[model samples]
Target: MEKTFTEEQRNFKELAIEFARRELNPGSRERERRGEFSEAGWQKCAAFGIPGITMPQEYGGLGLDTMTCIATMEGLGYACRDSGLIFSLNSHIWTCESPINKFGSESQKRKYLPGLISGSLKGGHAMTEPDAGSDAFSMRCRAEKKGSHYVLNGSKTFITNAPIADLLLVFAVTDKGKGFAGVSAFIVERGFPGFSTGSALEMMGLKTCPLGEVFLQDCEVPEENRLGQEGAGAAIFNSEMEWERSCLFAAHLGAMEKILESCIAYARERRQFGKAIGKNQSVSHKIADMKVRIELSRLMLHKVAGLKGAGKRAPLESAMAKLFISESYVQIATDALQIHGAYGYSAEYEFERNLRDAIAGKIYSGTSEIQRNIIATFLGL
Candidate 1:
């Protein structure tokens, strides 16, 4: 499919590029060294209308169309080097903000959407447990409906914004025997009784985004806090995932473009033996591969975004985009590192961090293996 941006998209992309450069890139390397999440950078993004791009205007959002959002995100990735912060923002935008906007009752939206979109209330969904990685429906978190409230008991690990989150969208089993149908979703306050967050776990990369555990032991949530209806967690999760897979990796695509551009620039400048490195087939071929991956990744990402912009569900397309872009990102990152030679191996160089961040794309949202399974099942496997 041929993709062309309209005037609005072009404007949004320009705005995003400027915003990321001015607001998000400063102090990024230092923050990354300390593994710190930048609160100021997050608010800067909020002021730029990033966290709320897809939400309605009344809720402090830009209310941009999906492709425009994607385009702006690509711009953000291209200009910003803080991949972890971008990842955190993406998690909040898609997994938390979009679902609440789509499935939330008006009161829920009025209560939560504005704070979240404004970046005053950072949060993310809690679905993955120690045991429920790929088998999400096998969640052991139990919620017992007791009069006007539900009592929750379980622990969720590897949550993206757990330590800093003021709120959390939690999934639990409301009916033990119904399997997936038993699952239910709820919004829990950080201070709610029995709700606690663990220390941020250090990771191989994307350390600027806090990752930790959410523990809910005998936590009571008012019935009013439940998302959608009773036993609707599965549907809500799938709904979130479809949007997440389709759009969340947009920044990574932007990173790939940036990496490709940087490598090309380097190839033209660095002299190997006698001529520029771009002269060698070994060096030039990697750059060529990077170009192909970026082109294909952009096309696929755009296709899924266009589908979503039309209000159609795109699980299969989203899976393909997620699978392709993520794997391609790692490949491009690897190649970028190779092209940078020894410099890529040093912390002083951006390529080292780029490769580290790209490796994570394969694991989150759904692993590459899981994406293939979803694609296979969609193809009548």
Candidate 2:
């Protein structure tokens, strides 16, 4: 992996690690305990150029490649204890910013990208309805075209950043007869008439990220706000998912490395009986497994990044990477907790928090089961 990056990319990773330790690490524990969303932290990340890593320079971004984005995210994950902050940042980048950058009209790009990239405007997307999670194409939300505008109706649950988002790329059915092709996406502002957000929903992890519900009841959207052509929602969605599976999971690889290092340190310093616990085959082997997971996760994640950087579609590779990295993080977290014994289970240490966060990795950005199904379909099974 060392040879995989240019000197500039490696420098970006190192800079991100140092910046995260200095800026995002403070008060993270207290913020998580209170489920607080840190506007200050968000701005700090924006100021540090996180939100704009992969965006165009004209849009106030760094205009870097996908590998740099992944590397920077990995560095942030390794150094920053605020997993929820990083989670929210990933959601903002992959789902909202990347979509508009890819598919939005020039006017739309001129309108939204600057604020989004600068973190002056929080953004996300509304796609997963209460009934449409894994079967996301089966969404019931409808958008009826009326003259120069469209009126949107339906609700989205488990929407990341909904409670505090400035805008969302909302998906809704425009033609029931067309199945997945019937759907269209709209760049809906939070203040759009008849659009309201539910209070933030509490979760087992990523609490500070502010997950919630979005309700669009006859919500009026200008025709100009429509993203791409009508019925392009499915394509837009798949594109974003590929990006999410590739880039969002890079943070998990970083977190796994961090946890493995912690466990190794604990195993070496803490003694059992007459020797360090690391001397025991049982403890040492568990640590060894962690190292293997981190290496494998890095390889798979970098493969997806390399593919995307080359302007290639990687549905199969992204699925495999997401599934493997997410599951690996969960297993690694579990092992770290066990290795630390009571300290891992207790809140005094961050291991317990890491475990909670890792479990969510398996569920989001396409669940592990969903990824396996995608892979099987790709194999012609």
Each model's lDDT? 0.90, 0.92
- Point out where model 1 deviates above 4 Å: 1-3
lDDT of 1 by residue, 1-381 (tens): 114788888788778888888888989999999999999999988888888888899988888799888888888888888889999998888888888999999999999999999999998999999999998888889999899999999999999999999988999999889888899899999989999999999999998999999999999899999999988999999989888887778888888888988999999999978999999999999999988988988888888888888998889999999999999999988888888889988888888898888888899899999999999999899
Specify the poorest-scoring 10-residue window by lDDT in model 1: 1-10
Best by lDDT: 2
> How does each model score on TM-score?
0.98, 0.99
Cα lDDT over the full model 2: 0.92
Runs in model 2 deviating more than 4 A are none
Clashing pairs in 2: none
Residue 40 Cα positional deviation in candidate 2, in Å, after optimal superposition: 0.2
lDDT of 1 at 251: 86
